[model samples]
Target: MEFFYFLLIGAISGWLAGQLWKGSGFGLIGNIVAGIIGGIFGGWLASKLGIGGGGLLWQIVIAAGGAWILLFIISLFKK
Candidate 1:
């Protein structure tokens, strides 16, 4: 279903962001939360940047990028 696909994307995005960020990986639930939120942020950012009509792959890329940014901000506050 579409919902499952969304969740799958979020999980993948979160996991990918975590791996790429290094020492900033949140656990499963956290990853899901971050990914979902990041997806929203990414979508907003993409729209603001005039990037639209992206497919699933583009969505994942944007989501991962957003997740990475989110983690980076959190890391800053933690320091």
Candidate 2:
């Protein structure tokens, strides 16, 4: 289902973001939340920025990129 894909992409995006940033993850639930939020932001930003990519993989990539941005901000606050 579409919803399942959204969650899946979001989870993977969060995981990938965690991996991108060292010591930046709140665990599964945190990741999901971050990922979902990032996915929406990323998708919108990508469209606005005219970044071109296709398919589920592209979606995950963009979402993860956005997640990384958010996680970085959170890390800044935590420090």
TM-score of each: 0.86, 0.88
| Model 1 weakest 10-residue run by lDDT | 23-32
Off by over 4 Å in 2: none
| Local accuracy of candidate 1 as per-residue lDDT tens digits, 1-79 | 9888888888889888888878557777787778878888888898999987668899999998888888888889978
Best by TM-score: 2
Clashing pairs in 1: none
Q: Scored by CA lDDT, what does every candidate get?
A: 0.83, 0.87
If candidate 1 were superposed on the true structure by all CA atoms, what would the RMSD be? 1.5
Given candidate 1, what's the lDDT at residue 3? 85
- Indicate the residue-level lDDT of 23 in model 2: 55
TM-score of decoy 2: 0.88
lDDT per residue, candidate 2, 1-79, as tens digits? 9999899999999988877777558787787788989999899899999996889899999999888888878879988
